[model samples]
Target chain A: MEMYWLLGLPLAGGITLAFWGHRAHAPEINAAFSLATLIAAGWLTAHIVAEGPVLIGGDGWFYIDAFNVFLVALTAFVAFTTALFSRPYMRIEQAHGRVNAARLRLYHASYQLFIGTMLLALTTNNMGILWVAMEAATLTTVLLVSLYRTPAALEAAWKYFILCGVGIALALFGTILLYFAAEQVLGAGGGALSWTHLNAVKTRLEPVVLQLAFVFLLVGYGTKVGLVPLHSWLPDAHGEGPTPISAVLSGLLLNVALYAVMRSKVLVDGALGGASLAGALMMGFGLLSVLVAALLIRRQTDVKRMFAYSSIEHMGLITFAFGMGGMVASFAALLHMTVHSLTKSAIFYAVGHATQKAGTQVMEDIRGLIKTNPTIGWGLILGTIAILGVPPFGVFASEFLIITTTMHQHPWATPVLLTALGVAFAAMFGRVQPMVFGETTLPRLPHQPALLPVFVHLALVLMLGLFIPGYLAHWYRQAACLLGG
Target chain B: MSLTYHLQVVNLLAALLLLIAFAMLSQRRIVGLITLFAWQGAALATSTAIVAWSTGQHHLYYSAALTLGLKVVLVPWYFFRLIRQLDVDREVEPMINIPTTMLIGIILVIFAFNLALPISQMAGTVTRSTLGIALASVLLAFLMMITRSKAIPQVIGFLAMENGLFFAATSATYGMPLVVELGVALDVLVAVFVLGIFFFHIRETFDSMDLKHMERLREK
Candidate 1:
C-alpha cells in the first residue's frame, strides 16, 4: 500500500497541479509535491532495507528490489532538487520574457508528470507497463522540451518525438516477441509477460527468438539511452529544452532508460547462457558513444548542448562498465550511475544559473562569471571539475573502478576508455574556463540566484567520493548480484 | 469455411495488403495516399478476421473490429479532416523519384521475404505464409517514410508500418494480448492527434509542411 503511494502521490499531484498550477503559488505547489514524493521514496527505501526486496500488489504489477529502490530514491531526490531550483530559474526566464505565465504552468505540470512517468518506469515489473511508462515520459518531456515554442524548440521536440516514438515502437515489437517466446513455455496469458517469471524461465527460452528480440530491444532502448548512431536526438533535445528539463534529462531520464535496458539485459544474459554476444554489442555501442561524444563535445557552441553530449559520454562509460559484467564492474557501473546523475545534474543547475546571469547560452558570448557572480562562477567550475572526473568527486571514484576493472578484464579497451575520458575532460574544462575566468560580457542580475540545489548535489557527490557509506556499498552489492555479477 | 480455403483467402488479402503498401509508396497526392492507407487497413482487417476464424481465436474478432474501426474508419477520417483543415491536399513528391522508390520497395520486399523465411517456418499458424508479406509491408512502409519529404505522408507511413506490425503479430503469434492491442490503439490515436497539432505548429513556424526546414537544427 505504501508502495502504491510512492508512485501515486506524484502522479495524482502532477495531474491536479496541472489544472491549478497557473495560480500564484505554482512552484511552491510543485516543490511540495516533489518533497512529498521524496519522503515517500525514502520511506519505501527504509522498508526495503528492513525487509528484503518486497513484491507488492501481487502477480507482477509492482516489484521493488535493491536495484530499483536505489534508482527510485535517487530519481525522487534529483527531481525534488530540480523542482526547487526550477522555481527561481523559471521565474527569471519569465522576467526575461523567454517564458510567460501559461508556459510556466505547463512547465510545472509537465515537470511533475515527467517525474511520475519515470517512477512508473522504475517500479513496474510488467514489461508492457514499462514500455508505456517510457513512452509517457517521452510525451511529457516533449511538451516540456517545446514549452518555449521557438522554432528550434519545436524541431527538437519533433525530432525527439519521432525518433523515440519509432524506437519505442520497435521495442514494443521486441516485447511482443519476448512474450511470444515465453508463451510456449509459460502458457499464454497472465504472468508470461512478467519480468520475474521471464527471468525465472529465461534459460528455457528459445535462443533465436530471444536473440532477435534483444537486437530490437537494444536498438530501441539504446536510442533512448543516447547511444551513438541512434543518439542524434539527444543533444538537440537537451540543448533546446528548458534548462530544468535539461537537468532532468541529463540527471534522471537517461538513467531510467538505462535501467530499462539493464532489466532486459539481465534476461538476455540468462537466456544466452552467459554468452558474450549481448555484452559485446553493448560494449561496441558504449565505446562508439563515448568516442563520438568526446569528439563532438569540443565543437559544440551551445553550453547546454555541450553538456548534453557530456551526458552521452558519461552514459557511454557507465554502459561500458555494465557491459563488462562482473562483481566489480557492475558495482562500479551502478555507483557510476548514482554519481553521474548527481554530478551532471549539479552541473546543469550551475550552468542554468550561469547562463541566465550571462543572458546567453552561447559559449563565446559569456565571460567573467567569477567577476560578476563568484558563487555561481565557482559552482560551475567545481561542478565541471566533478563531472570531468577529477578526484574528490564520486564520478572519479566510479570511473576509477571502471578503469581498473577494464584494465584487468579488458586490457585493450582500457586505452580507449582512458583516451575518451581525457578528451571529454579537456573539452568540458577548456570551454568552461573562459566563461568562468574572463572579462565580463553582461552584468549579473540583481536578484540573488538559487545556488542551494547546486551546492547540495555537489556536496552529496563529494561525500560519496570520499567515503562509500556502508549501506550504499551493501545495496550496490545486492543489485550487482541481481545483474548476474 | 474450410481451413485451407480460409488460409487461401488470408494469402490473397495479404497480397492485396502488400500491393496497397506499394501503391502508397508510389502515390503522389496526399488524399490518394490516405485513401490507399485505408484500403491497406481494410485488407489487414479482412486477413485478421479470416485467420481468427480459421484458428478459432475468438478475441481476434475483437482485434479485427478494432483495427477496422481505428485504421479503416477513424484515423483516415481524422487525416481527411486534417488535410482539409490544413489545405495541404496536393502533390506529394518523394525525396527519391517514383521509379527509384518503386524499385527500392521491390528490393525491400525481397529482402523482407528472405529475412522472414527462417522465422516464418518457426511460426505454427494458419497465416504463417502471410508473415513474409507482413514483414515486406513493414519494410516498404519504412522505405516510404524515408523517401517522402512531406510531413503528412511520413506520418501515414508510420501508421502503415504499425499496420504491418499488427499483421505480423497476428500472423506470427495469433496477435498480442487484447489489453496491449487496446493500449497500442489508444497510443496510435493519441500520437496522431499530437502530430496533427504539430502540423499546425510546423506550418506556423516555417509556412510549410516540408521536413527539410527542420534540418537547420542539426549540429553545425
Candidate 2:
C-alpha cells in the first residue's frame, strides 16, 4: 500500500544510511530517499482524494484524512528540498573543517530517522503512538543538533533534550489520564488509546478528566510548538544546529507538533460541548508567542536565531487563527501552515548560503550578498519580503484572511495582532535589507550554491498569494471542516 | 477481600515511592541521587507487579518486568558506570538549598494532590488511591531537577519522573496497551543512552558537568 511506502522509505533510508552515509555520494542518497518519500506522499494524497478518509493497517492504526493529508505532502516536499540544499551546504561545512566524515554519517542517518519519526507522529491513529513517535523525533534531532559538539551546540541540544523530555513526560501522563477516562467507556485494551474510538465516544467521556488531560497535553505538546515561555529551546536549537536541520525544525517539526495539539483540541472540544475553553487557552498562548517573538526578533545578532524567532512568530499566528475556531479561521490556519513552511525553509536555504559565503552567522559581519552572489542575495530579499507578508505573497493572503476574521469575531485582539505584525515586519525588514543590498568585500565560494529549491518554494508561495487553485481551496475547506469550528 | 489486601500493598509501595522521592530531593551527592533513583524504580516495579496480579491484566506483568530490567538493573548499572567513569561523584550543591527545595517539594505535593483529587475520584481502578502519590512523585522529581545545577542529578531527576509516570499509568488505568508500554520503555532507554552520551560530550567541552558552564547561550 502507498501508506506503507510513505512511512517505510525514510525508515529504510535511515537504516541504510547508518551504514553507508560516510561515502562521497551519501548526500545524493539522502536526497534520493527524500524524493522517494515525496513521491509516495503524492501518491497517498491522490489516493486519499479519490477514496475519501480511510484507516490503514490492522484495526486502523494509521488514519489518513483531509486534515493531515495536505500536511503530509508538505512535510515530504520540504524535506526533499532541504536534503538537496544540505548536500552542498554540508560539503562546505566539511571543507571548512567544522565536521568530519563520521559526523556527516551521523547527520545523514539521523536526518532520515528524524523525518520518519515526524511522519509517524503525523499519521499514527493511536494517541499513545503519537506520543511515542513525537518523543522519538525529539531524540533523533537532539543528536543532530549536537552533531557539531561545540559548547554552544551541545548546550542547545541538552536544553532541547531535557526541556522536551520533561514536557513530553507530562504529555504521557495526560495520555494515561485520557486512557483512564476511555477505559470506563471503551474498556481496557489498545482500543482505549485509539483516536478514532475516542472521538466516537467523546461526548460520553468524563469532562473533568478530559479538561485535566487537555491542560497537560497542551503544556506538554505546546513546548514543542515553541509557544511563548516554553520557547527558549527553539531559538537556541535552530541557531546552533546545521542549517538544514534548522530548515526542517522550523518548517516541518514545529508544524507536526502543532498538528498534535490541534488533534487533541478536537477531542477536548467535543467532550466539553464547545470550543470556548480550549480556544481561549490556545489564543492566550498564541498571542503571547507572537508578541514575544516579534519583540525578540529585534535583538538577535545571529541571522539563524533571528529567523528562528520569526518561525515562532508565524507559528504563533497560525495557532491564534486556529484558536479563533471558525471555518474561515481554520482554513486560513491551514494556508498559513503551508506558506510558512515553504517560505521559512526557503529563507533558511538562502540564509544558509549567505552565512557560508560570509563565514559567520553574525548579522553585522555579513554584507553585500547581492555583490557576492546575486541569486542567493535576491533569493534572500524575495524570501524575506514574502515572509514579512508583503503583498502578492501567500503569507499576506493568509494573514489578511486571519485579520479580517479576527476583526469580525474578536475586535479587542486586533490591535495586539497588528502591533506584533508591524513590529516584526520592521525588525525583520530593517535587519535583512542591509545584509542583502549593502556593499561588502566577501568572495565567492568554490561550490555553486543550490538556489533552485529556494526559488521553487518562493515561486509556489507567489502563485499561492496571487490565486488559490480550485482543488487546493476545496482541500483546505475539507480539512477545516474536519478540524471543526 | 483479597483485592483489598492487594490494594493495601500497592498503597504501601506508593507511599514508599513518595518517601524516596522526597529523600532524592534532599540528597546532595550525585551517587546518593542515583541510588535513590534505583530505589524509586524498585518501588515502582513492585507496585506495578502487585497491581498486575490483582487486576489480571497480563500486559502489566510484562511492563513490571521491563521496569525491573531497565529501571532497576540496567539503567542503574549504566549510571553507576557513567559516574565512575566521569569521576563526578562529588557533592552537588543545589541552586536552592536542601531545606528550601524540600519545602517547595512539599508545596508541590499538596498542589499535585489537590489537582489529582477530581480525576482520581473518577478513576475506577482498585489502585486509584495511589494516583495522587504518583503525581506527587512526578512533581517532586521535577523540583529536584530545577534545584540541581549538575547534569547527572538533573538526568536522574528526569528518569525518576518517568518512573512516576509509569506508576500513574498502572494505578489509574492499569497500564497502557502492551505495544505502547513497550514503545515508552524503549524511548526511555534510548533517552537515557542519548543523555549519557551527551554527559561525556558536555564534560569534554566544559571540563566539568556543572550546568553553570552552559550559561553562555542566551539572548544578548
- Choose the strongest candidate by lDDT: 2
Instruction: Put down candidate 2 lDDT per residue, A61-173, tens digits, no spaces.
Output: 99999989999999999999999999999999999999999999989999999999999999999999999999999999998999889999999998999899999999998
Score candidate 2 by TM-score against the native.
0.99
- Candidate 2 clashes between residue pairs 3 or more apart in a chain or in different chains: none
* Candidate topping TM-score: 2
Give lDDT tens digits, candidate 2, residues B73-126.
999999999988998776566555678778888899999899888888888888
Lowest summed lDDT across 10 adjacent residues in model 1 chain A is found at: A185-194
Candidate 1 ranges with C-alpha deviation above 4 Å: none
lDDT of 1 by residue, A334-354 (tens): 999998898888888888988
| Alpha carbon lDDT of each predicted model | 0.87, 0.92
Q: Show model 2 residue runs off by greater than 4 Å.
A: B90-96
For each candidate, give the interface RMSD after superposing the true interface residues on Cα: 1.6, 0.8
What local lDDT does model 1 show for residue B80?
Answer: 97
Model 1: lDDT of residue A112: 86
